[model samples]
Target: MNNLASQEQIIATAILIVIYMAVVLWLVIRGARKTTNIGEYALGTIGFSPVAVGLALAASMTSAATFIINPGFIALYGFSGFLSFGIVMPIAIYFSLIVITKGFRKYGSSVKALTMAQWIGKMFNSQRYAIFFAFLSLLLITFIVLICVGITQVLSNALNADPFWVLLAVVVFVFGYMMFGGANSLVYTNAIQASIMLVVAIVLLSSGLEYFEGGVDGFIAKLASIDPALVKPTNPDSLLFRDYFEIIFCQLVIGVAIVCQPHIMTKSLLLKKDEDVNKYLVVSIIALTFFFLVVFVGLYVRVYFPDLKVGGQVLPMDSLVSAYVVSKFSVYVSLIVIIGLISAGLSTLEGLIQSISSTITADLLDPLLGKELKLDIDSNQILTNKIVIVLLAAISFGLSYQQLVSPNLSVGIFAQNGVYAYFSAAFVPVIFGTFLKKTSLKAVSIASVTAIVVHFSVYYGKFMPYMKEEVNNPAIAATMAILISVVVGGIIHQLEFSKANNKEALNVH
Candidate 1:
């Protein structure tokens, strides 16, 4: 694979990346000028068009997992991976996004909520609940690690450099800019990144048109020739997509819950006007639909490397997309794809850094140190946020290096485990808080705790049959956790409601 990228190609890619970084830094500086207080830093002071925020949402939602990592799953597991990731998950995500965005934004903007923890805490009127979620937001670091590993793979392959150095460079550069840029810079940078990704998605999807020259059946037959299971909707031999339960049910449940994450759900609050909400949803969903389909490129790469080998060495799933870009495209084309891939990772990385660091500073530290200790936390919060980003960068680099060096199948697994648990715990609280007129704080709190416990117990303890395997599906554990939490929370809410009604009736009599 190293031989596939010429010396000229490497130099061209390196130069393009440098110019790309410069453009991003310029955007950050422009945005930072508007970011004076923690509020502006978190939500941005500038008014952005619905279309731009929509693009930012699309870019953040479709991270490197869409462009770089998940394709590796499709490459390995075949049609089953497409069914689960490409088809099932997107359907659930878009539906959930549309359903939740309106109500969330209405409440978020009204209260001037800055982070998920702040929203949840205000919703429940419980400072402890907010602090709990603040701690849980730390789980998002796993997702940051994922984006770092993905960008590292693309950059390392494009420049023919050591992945360790690439990973280190990616973390420092992206996290450094995010320390000051916050949401102000993130939206503009993400909109630009999303535009590049849109073109690159089309380029990548159409790159293997020759495979479809004989139509859909011919493409299936080509894959079947490689392995009959490649054409099947369910790959029993695979670790993640073994049956309808894993492919359809689990992914469907996880998809709806996935939008509960802070970076995704809070995007609506960026829109200032009620009229903008509908347009934001429409544009983002349409763009994300196309971006999600980019995973189909994995099948093309599968056909390219039938045995999943290049230059007599087996290609790791994470490197499959990078290898394909360099080997299959011209130098110029490869550089475009490389930049798009980096954008995919950076767009999401910026969001995570902004949202998570804000959670630490505003939701976690300010509450604990300021209110609790009567300190002037707000006076130096922006500086504290920058320090939080630095700490996050260090943690992300360490975890990302581990994934790059020794992954269990792919970094996707490690990420899904932590991310799934988070949104799983968040699902009931977010859903009930958004739609229900009245909710029991105790009930929602119990539900959240149940989700965390159930998710890890099923995942680590191997309680479910799906978990009995050597490599478990985080979706399965997450789905079970979600189901149980919903049931528990529902029961508790009803019981409390009935008891309160009885008390009111007695008082009236």
Candidate 2:
């Protein structure tokens, strides 16, 4: 594979990444000095501004999933798929701003919530529920790390570089910043990254429109020419409209899992004031609206590069919509695209690694295994977090190498499916419990556990049978699992409330 980029483009991309790395590192280092305890490091000593929090939240929520996979879908499913999934983002922003702001502020700093599981446990008064939720949270973070690694590898391939080295470089850069800055630094960096992403996405879309023969309409015609189904709202040959609708609903609910995500919620605890939440909401929503255009670029790419192949799958690189421009445009423009996408990936992974490390240290190890290790919770937790970051980076680095050696063996399905299953079970019950004061801890616990177990069982079982030549989209399976969790969690929560009320009445009599 040719490097296919000019020296000027390469130098510019390198300079941009270096500047980004330095800025993020400086922020983290500044924050690190203020972190005296586990709470401060993991949750930010004082609250961050809502603008910062919101931007970080949006960036973390998008991740390589948006950068890489969404484009892949656009290549195959066409613009309709982009619209279907893309629509939920605005809804997510609205919920965060209108529905969630007041609730989050009222909850405030008292909770010291580092993970979504902790938030759920606090709301429901059940550590068992927290533990189950933590497991799911763990799975989600794992998938994120896997995706980060996957995208870095893909980027490396596109650059004609060694995939392992790219993974190693990214892991170290992210881990270093995250370990130094903690939550506060992560949010600050994310805000900057979000800005870069918005600018870059806009530039790519504009340039692409100018360069393409048909613009969006012309591109659509090309797609329809190849396969008429490309323009259809849904492809009956592949996915049904009912399935697509269900997928939309499921993704929307799963989107709530973002509210409960450890990395994103940690920003809530870091809020400098309640007002910051408002600012963060506005900034995040506005930025995300622009970023959504990135998906449109993917759809645009499908029109021209209909025959490109990735991983034995005949698919266009929808995820790298900007990269298509690189093949056509001057090196400087392509450099901008690379810089933006790389920033998106790096800033996101930085938050993810730190958040996961904090979870392992604070939520998992210190609580469960610290005493046996003969160390106090606070000091030991810090040490453990650092160690976990290094180990995680190494593991990710090794995995990237393995992926390059045997691309087929390195399919990212396991991580994605596992996360979907975990979040569906973990977040649905907790969010529902938050609004229902009467929702019992016991019911929450049962529902939470059942969601985890049932999701895993069906996921690995006959529900999405592996025996099929063309497997059902993991997105569809995930949506089904989330729906089941919502139904079951709601029922269990109601049942527990009724039983508790009856018991109280009998005791009073």
Candidate 3:
């Protein structure tokens, strides 16, 4: 796809990247100065404006998958991809985020919960449950790998450099700075990244306007001329968006549960005042509506590369957006898009590193070592958190390198399998714990285990008809898991409640 950039473009990109890195480092240093303990590191002591935190939430929620990887899917599958990723998913996610955030933050702040695992543990009065989730949070490293691969693809193509070296440099620089900044720097950096991404989203979305010259029908006609399936709302040739169930139902369910991730849901805790929640949600929903629509650029890129090849080489799915950027835009404009792409990845990357490392250090290690072994982890938690980030960086690099060299379909699939499972298990617990006045820990725990089992089993075993394909859809597996777990959890909760009520009646009589 003529992915290599011109020497002039490469030099300009490198220079701008250096300036960006310097600015980010300066902000990290500024934030690190105020971060004296784990509490400040996880949920900053500073009272940031709701607008900034809202921007951060939008950026963190819209990962590289939105900007770089998922568009590749849209390019391959066409309008059906847009219907699922751009439309249905965003609507469900916004609704779920609005429903869950305020209640979670109210309890989280009241309990001084530092991580999602800690929040769940405290809500159910079960440290063991929190520990289990802390370990499960390791699965988010797959998501980190997805972001790293995304940034690597953008940078490597722009610089005409080796992907391995680019990946290494990205992981080191990001993870190294993240060792200090935590939430304090994360909010500001993410806000800046979000602003850049918002501009790029507009540019990419508008880039396809010329295709709409003959009107919306003309655009559909153009796609239909290439491949009739491209214009269809449901593409039979595609694995992920083959029917109403996959395109709408599965995506809707996934979108609702997707916010259960630590990096996403815990973002509300960044706000100090209750009054700020509505403003924060309003800004986030508005910005994210634009960010998710950027996937439409895939259809534009597809129209540009009808054969899905350039220079007689078939373009890889993960590299579609990168190839399009370098080919479609002038050198200067390409550099700006490249910066925004990097921001899209870095915003979510920073949040994952901060949240997961905090989960490991605060939720997992502190409970085991400090309480059980009587170790002084409390005094050295900051140091311990840095160590955890280093470990996570190493793991992310190994897995990302594998995906870069040889992926099943795209790293998006690999990420979805892991991330979807984690959140599917979390969905019941987070929902029941937040809204229900009296929740049975046993019921939630059973539901969580059921979710994990069902997700992996269905994914690996190909239990459902939708999963019979070689590259199965993780969303389908996740949806089944979420539904089954909710049913199982609900029944158990009712049984427990009824038994307790009966006991109270007998005692009163």
Error of 3 at 350 (Å): 0.4
Error of 2 at 355 (Å): 1.9
Question: For candidate 2, what is the TM-score?
Answer: 0.88
Worst 10 residues of 3 by lDDT: 370-379
- lDDT digits (tens) for residues 414-469 of candidate 1: 99999999999999999999998789998899999999999999999999777888
Model 3, runs deviating above 4 Å: 1-3, 371-379
lDDT of 1: 0.92
TM-score of each candidate structure, all chains considered together: 0.98, 0.88, 0.98
Residue-level lDDT tens digits of model 2 in 263-284: 6555656676676666776777
The candidate maximizing lDDT is: 3
- lDDT scores of the candidates, listed in order: 0.92, 0.62, 0.94
Show model 1 residue runs off by greater than 4 Å.
1-3, 371-379
Q: How much is 377 displaced in model 2, in angstroms?
A: 5.9
When 2 and 3 are scored with lDDT, the better candidate is 3
Winner on lDDT between 1 and 2 is 1
